[model samples]
Target: MRLTMLRGPLLVAPIALLTLIPLLVVLGSFLHPQPEVWAHLSEYVLPEVINNTLILMLGVGCGVLLLGVPLAWFTAVCEFPGRRFFSWALMLPLAMPAYVLAFVQVGLLDFTGPVQTLIRDIGGDSSWFPRIRSIGGVVLVLSLAFYPYVYLLARNAFLTQGKRALEAAQMLGLSRAQGFWQVALPMARPWLIGGLTLALMETLADFGTVAIFNFDTFTTAIYKSWFSLFNLPAASQLASLLVIFVLVLVGMEHWARGARHYHSRIVAAERIQLKRWHQIAVIALCSAVLLIAFVIPVIQLLVWAKSILQEDLDSRYLGFTLRSMMISILAASLVSLLALLLVFIARRFNSRATRWMVRLATLGYAVPGSVLAVGVFLPIAWLDNLLIPIAQSMGFATFQVLKGSVAVMLLALAARFMAVAFQPMDSTMQRISRNQEDAARSLGLNQRQLLWRLHLPMLRGGMLTALLMCFVDVMKEMPITLMTRPFGWDTLAVRVFEMTSEGMWANAALPSLMIVLTGLIPVVLLVIQSENKQD
Candidate 1:
C-alpha cells in the first residue's frame, strides 16, 4: 500500500506539472499584474471586442459551411475525372495560414498591385476591382483557408454513412435529395458541427489576419493593450473577456454534439456509388474550392515570390531559418511526449476531472496567441521575479529559471500545442482494446512493461501524427513567439511576420514556403492515416 501510494504520485507528476504551468500563469497574473492599468482601458473596449469576435466567429462559421458542405456532398455522391485527387485535394488549404493567404491575395489583387497596375495601364482605375481589404475580403480569405476544417469532418462523416440507411430512405419513397436532407444530413450534423466549431474558434482567435486588414477584434485589442500600450493588466482583463467568449462558443459546440450523436442501425453497410453527373459536379465543385482556397492565393504568392527573387535571398536570413526549425522541432517533440504521458495517465486513472482539465488546456488551440501570451506571461514573470531576487540574495550563480530562457518558449509551446498532440492520441487510444493490458497483467507484466509492449506499438501512428501536428503548429505559430520569446529568440513564424510587416515578400517567401511545407507534413500524414482507417 505504501509503495502503490508512492508510485501513484511518481506516475502522476508529469500531469501535475503540465496542468500547473498554465494554472500558475493564470493565477499569478491575477496576483501581480501590470501597475495602474485599470484606468487606461475604455469601457467600450469590452463590448466592441465581444461583438466583433462573435461576428467574425459567426461569419467564418457560415462561410466555411457554405463552401465545405456542398463540395463534400458533390464529391461524395458524384464521380469525376479528378475524383481521386478531389478526395484529398480539398484538404490542402489547411497547410496554408490565413494571414499569409490574406496578404498574398491583397498583394496580387490590391490597387497598384500587378493586376491593378496592368488594368490601369490598359484603361482601368480604382473602381475596376474592389479592394480585397474589406470585411467581405477577410471573410473570403478565411473561408478559403478554413473550409478544409469542415471538409475533412463532413467528408469523413459522409464516407462512413451506411448505404442501407439511404436505401431504406429510397424504399420509403424519398428522392435522392430528400434522402440526403432527411436521412444523411441528420447523421452528418454531429461531424459537421464538430468541424464548424473548430473553424469558428479559429476565426475568433485569429489576430494576424484580422489585424492586417485593420479589423479591431478582441484579439487585436489584446495585442494593442499588451504590445502597444504596454499594459499587461488590461490585456489580461481583455483576455479574460476573450476566454469567456471562447468558452461560450465551446459550450455551444459541446451542447450541439451532445444533442446530435448519430447511431448506425446496420452493421458493415455498403459504400454509396457515384455517377457521371456527379463527376461533373464534383469536378466543378473541387475546381471552385481550389480556385478560392489554393490556386488564387498561391498564384499570388508565386507572383510575389518571383518579385522576391528580384529583391534578395541572402545569407542573413538563413541562420534564422535553421534556428526557427530547430526550436520548433524540439518544442513540438517535447509537447508530444508530454501529451502522450498525460493521455496515458488519463486512460489509466479514468479521472473525469483530469479529462476536463485536459480538454480545458486544449482551449489554447482556440485562443489567439496574443491573448495566450498574457495568460502565459503573467504567472511565469511573477514567479521569475520572486526566484531571481531570491537566487541573487542566496548568492547562487548557476542560471535563472524563467524570464529570458528557452524554457519559457517550450512551456508556451507545450501549453498551446498540447491539444494537437493529444487529440490524435486520444482518438487512437479509444480504438484500442483493454484486453492487451489485462492479458499482460495476468502474464506477470508490470504496468510499464504492458504499456511499452502493447500500447506503444498500437499507438505508434498516433504518436507520429501528434508529433508532426505539434511540430507544424510550433513552426507556424507567431503570437507567443512575438510576446514570450527570449531576448534574441525568433522562430520561422516570427521572421515571416516581421518581413511581411514591412510589406516585404521576397525575404518572407522562403520561410513562408517552409512554414507551409512543414505544416503539410502532418496534414499529409493524417490524410494517409484516415485513408488507412477507411481501407
Candidate 2:
C-alpha cells in the first residue's frame, strides 16, 4: 500500500496527457450535438444502424462459436495428424484485416470471378452462386479472421483445466459426448464468451469490410456520413448509437462471467487421445475453415496481382503509404509507453478503484474507432489552440505544427490503441509475485529503483508484445484515422479504402497486401514465442 501510494506520479504522469483529453471530446459530443442531426437519428437512421449492427454481431457470434470451440477442442483434447501445425496455422487468419478479406472474397465470387468463369465453362449460370458483396460475405469473412480470438482463449482455458475431471466423468456412467457437453464446455464458457466478445467488437468496429461490400452497418454509415457526405453531426450521432450497442454487449459479458461459479482444479488432467475417425474429422474441419477464410481468398488476391504484373505504381500513393507507416510506428511507441504506465499503476494499487481505472482505459477498445476518434479530437484540438499561441508569444513560431499534423495522427493512434497496450501488461503483471517487490524493498531499494531494477526487467517481453501489437494495429487502422487525421495525411488503410472504393483494385490490392504483411510480423513473433515456451 505504501509503495503503491508513493508511486502514483511515476505511474500516472505519462498517461495524463492522453487520459484527460479523450473524455473531453466525448463529453462535448453529447452536450453539443446539432439539433438537425438529432432529428435525423431519432426518425430513421438510428434504428437501421442499430438493426444492422446487431445483425452483424449475431452472425459473428454464432460463426465464431461454431469454429472457435471445435478447433480449440481439436488441439486441446483430440489430436489429428497435422493438429500440431493447424493449431498455430489457424491463427494466420487473424493477421488478415476484414477489408482485405472482403476484397479477396468479392474478387473470387463476384460475377466475373474465377469461380463463376469455371461454372460458365461447365454450362452452368454464374447466378447459381450468390454475390459475395452482401451482409453474408461480411459475416463470413469476419468470423474466419476473428474466430482465432475464441480459439486462443478457449484452447488455453481447456489446457488449464486439463483432463483429470474428464477421466472421472468417463469412469462414471457418462459418455465422452455427455462429459464434454456437461463438464468441459461449462469450464471453458468464460474463455469462449471472452473470445466471442472480442470477435463481436472487431466485427462492430469494422469499416472497410462492410463498406466495400456495400453494407449499411454503423461503421460504414459513419464513414459515409463523416467523410463522403461531410455530415459530422450525423456521423457522431450514429457513432454514439454504435457505442451504446457495444457497451450493452460488454455489460452482458461482464454480467455472465460474474455470474459463473465454476472452479478450475490445479492438478493436471491426463490428456485425451483422439480416435482415428475423430482425428480425420478434426483435420477436415480445420482445412475447410482455412480454405474459405484464408487459402481461397489469398489465392484469389495473387491471381488478381498477376494481371497487374507490368503496371507502374503511382509515386504519390507509394509516398502516402510510406508516410502512414512512419506515423503508425511512432504512435505505436507512444501508446505502448503510456499503456505501460496505466498497467503498472493498476497492478501496483490492485484495489477496486484502480482496477476500475484499468477497465475504463480499456473501454476505448469496445467503443467504435470512430467514437474513440471523437473522444480524442475535440480536447486535443482545443489544447493545441491554447498551446500554439503561448509558444508563438514565446518566439516559437513552428509550434503550430501540431494543429492538424502528423503529431495529431500519432495521438489519435495512441487513444485508439491504449487497450492493446494494456492487455499484455495486465497479463504479465498477474504473474508477478508480491515477494519480489518485498525482497527489493528489504534490500533498501526505493520504489523507482525497485521498479526499474526488478519489475521492468521481468516485463520486457510483455512490453514488447504490447508495443508490437500497437504497431500493427495502427498500421491497419482506418476509422479513427479517417475521422481524426489532419488534411493531406494518408494511411495504408485509407489508401486501400480509397482505391477499393473507386474500383481501383490493382492499386488497392497492393496496399491491402502490405497491411496484412505488416500485421503478420508481430503475430509471427508472438507465435514463435508461444511455441518456444511450450517446448
Candidate 3:
C-alpha cells in the first residue's frame, strides 16, 4: 500500500521540477549582480519601460472592454442580422497572432506603403495618417488581436446567466438598459475580469508586436539586456521584475473575484429579437470588427502571397513548414503527456504539497516567452560548460550537449505552454466519478492499470483538445523560438519576423499566411465544439 502511494509522486515530481527550473533560474539571478548593466538600466531604461508598460495595459484594458463587452452582449442576448455568424466568426481573431497583425498593418499603413501612397497621390500629406509604429498603434493592434479573449468569456457568461435574473430586474421596474447595467453586467463581472486578465497577460508577454512598433516594454528590455548588452544576469533580473508584475496582476484579479458564488437558477432563454435598423447596426458593427481584425489582414496577406508565390514557394519554404510542424507536434505531445501525469498524480494523491507543486509547475505560462528563453538558456549553458572538462578527459574535447539544440527549444515550449495543455485535461478529469476508480480497485487493479484501462479511454476527447491547443500555440509562438532556435532552424514565425524586420512585407506574407492557416485548426475545433454544445 505504501509503495503504491509512493509511485504517483515519484513519476510526477521530476517533470514538475523540470517545468519549474527556468523560473527558479530567473528568481536566483536577484542574488547575483551585473552592476554596470543594472546601473545603466536603472538610470536610463527602467522608468520608460515601467511607464510604457502601464499605459499600454491601461489602453488595451479599456479598448477590449469597449469592443468586447457590447459585442458580446449583442451576440449573446440581442439577435441581429448576423448574430449567428458573429457568434463564431468573432473568434477568428484568436487565430491571428498580434505580431502577424502588426506586420500586416504596418505593411499596409506605413509611410511608403499602400495607404499613405494612395493618400499622397490624392493630394494628402503623410500627416493625414496616424503612425502605425507608435505606442498607440501597439495598443490598437493588441486590442484588436486580444479582444476575442474577452468576447469569448463575456459572451459565454451572458449566455449562461439564465433569463430569470434579467426578468426579475425588469419586473422591479428597471428598463432593459438599466437591467443590463445593474444586473447582467454585474453578474458577468467575474468572467469579464478573467478575460481581461488573460488579455493583459498576453499583452505583457508580447515581444514581437511591441518590438515591431519600437515600443519599449519589459519584454523588449529583457531582450536588449541579453542580446545587445550581453548581460544575462541583467536580463534575468528584468525577467524577475516582469514575473513580479504578472503576479500582482494575478493577485489583483483574484482579489476582484473575491469569494462570491454565482449560480443560475434557471436555464437560459431564447435571445431577444431586434428591430430592423438595430439589427443592421449590430451586423455592421460585427462586420467592421471582424473585417479589421481578421478579414482585412488575411486578405492583405493573401494578396502579397499571390504576388510572391512563385518566388517564395520552394524547397526551403517547404522545409520551414515541415520543421515547424515537427517541433509543434513534438512539443505538444510532450506537454500533453506531462500535463496528464501531473493531473493524474494530483487527483490520485489529493495531497496539499502535490497540489502546490502542480500550481508551481503551471506558472511558466504567465512568464513571458522572452523571459523564459533567458531562464532556459542560462542553466543549459552552465550544464554544457560543466560537462566540457569531463568530455576533454574522455578525449572527445567537445561535449556541448544542451546549447543550440532542438531539445532545449522543446523544453522551453513545454515549460511555457504546459498550462495550455493542463487546464482542459484537468477540467475533464474532474468530471470522472470516484466510483469507477473504487470499482477498479476492488477488482485488484492498481493505479497504473486503472489509469491505462479506464482514464485514458475516457479522456481521449480532452487529451486531443489539449494537444491541438498546445500545438497551435507553439506554431504561432515567436519570442521563445526566436531566442532559443539554433542557427538555420527557423520556424515560420521566425521567417515572418526576419522579413518584417528587413521591411520585406511581401516576402513575409507566405510564412505569415502559413502560420494563420495552421492556427485556424484549433479555432475551427472550438467553434465546432461550441456548436455541438448548442445542438
In terms of lDDT, the best-performing candidate is: 3
lDDT of each candidate versus the true structure: 0.74, 0.76, 0.87
Q: Mind giving the per-residue lDDT tens digits that candidate 1 earns over 398-469?
A: 445877677777777777777888889888888777876788889998988978887898899888888878
**All candidates: CA RMSD (Å):** 3.4, 3.3, 2.1
206-307 in candidate 3: lDDT tens per residue? 988988888999998988888788877788899988888988998999899999987643245877778998888888899999999999999999999999
Ranking by TM-score: 3, 2, 1
How much does candidate 1 score in TM-score?
0.89
Ordering by lDDT: 3, 2, 1
lDDT of 2 by residue, 1-535 (tens): 6666546554554465464456545555767778888887768676777777778889989999999998887777664588778878888887888888887777777888778999999987777687677778878888887998998888877776667657768899788889889888988889888999999988888888888888788887777777778886677666666766777888899898985576653344556778888778778888998888777767666666666755835676677777777877788788888788887787667666556556666666776787777656556667778888889889997575565666666766776678888888778877888887888899999989988998899889889889888888888888877777778678788888888888666667767777787888777876785565331
Runs in model 3 with CA error above 4 Å?
1-11, 264-266, 439-446
How big is the positional error of residue 45 in model 1, measured in Å on the Cα after superposition? 3.1
Higher-lDDT candidate of 1 and 3: 3
In terms of lDDT, the poorest run of 10 residues in model 3 is 262-271
Which portions of model 1 miss their true places by more than 4 Å?
1-40, 121-123, 126-128, 264-281, 351-354, 391-401, 533-535
User: Which pairs of residues have clashing backbones in candidate 1?
Assistant: 78-278, 79-279, 80-279, 308-506
